[model samples]
Target: MFSKEKIILAYTVEKCKKCNLERKRKYQEGDLLFAETSKCDSCDGIAVIEKIFGETIEK
Candidate 1:
């Protein structure tokens, strides 16, 4: 018997250059690359959308 199972998950990456902080979270609507996001938690820095990608995992 053969079975195939896989799941794909999307994610968004945000980074702050001032603090060199990086964050990853689930993908959301209206998210665009290089777009300015919320303030950083570590310091008074602005976080920007760095990248958006997806990964596949076996179930």
Candidate 2:
């Protein structure tokens, strides 16, 4: 029988080109790859979207 077993969660990864700072957060609307985002907390650099992916969680 077919049944639901796992939950897939989507995430977005952002990084700063100048400082190499990386961060992962939940996916949101209008998120596109290579898009410039907020400023980096560790340095004076702009964060850009690096990758977008999903992971399955066992229930």
Clashing pairs in 2: none
Q: How would you encode candidate 1's per-residue C-alpha lDDT over 2-39 as one tens digit per residue?
A: 77698999999999978979999999999999999899
> Which tens-of-lDDT digit does each residue in 1-59 have in candidate 2?
77769999999999999999999999998999999989998997999999999999976
- Candidate 1 least-lDDT 10 residues: 1-10
Clashes of each: 0, 0
Stretches of candidate 2 exceeding 4 Å from the true structure: 1-4
Candidate that would win on lDDT: 2
Q: Model 1 off-target regions past 4 Å?
A: none
Question: How high is the lDDT of residue 11 in model 2?
Answer: 98
Q: How close is candidate 1 to the true structure, as a TM-score?
A: 0.88
Model 2 residue 49 CA deviation in Å: 0.4
Estimate every model's Cα lDDT from 0 to 1: 0.94, 0.95
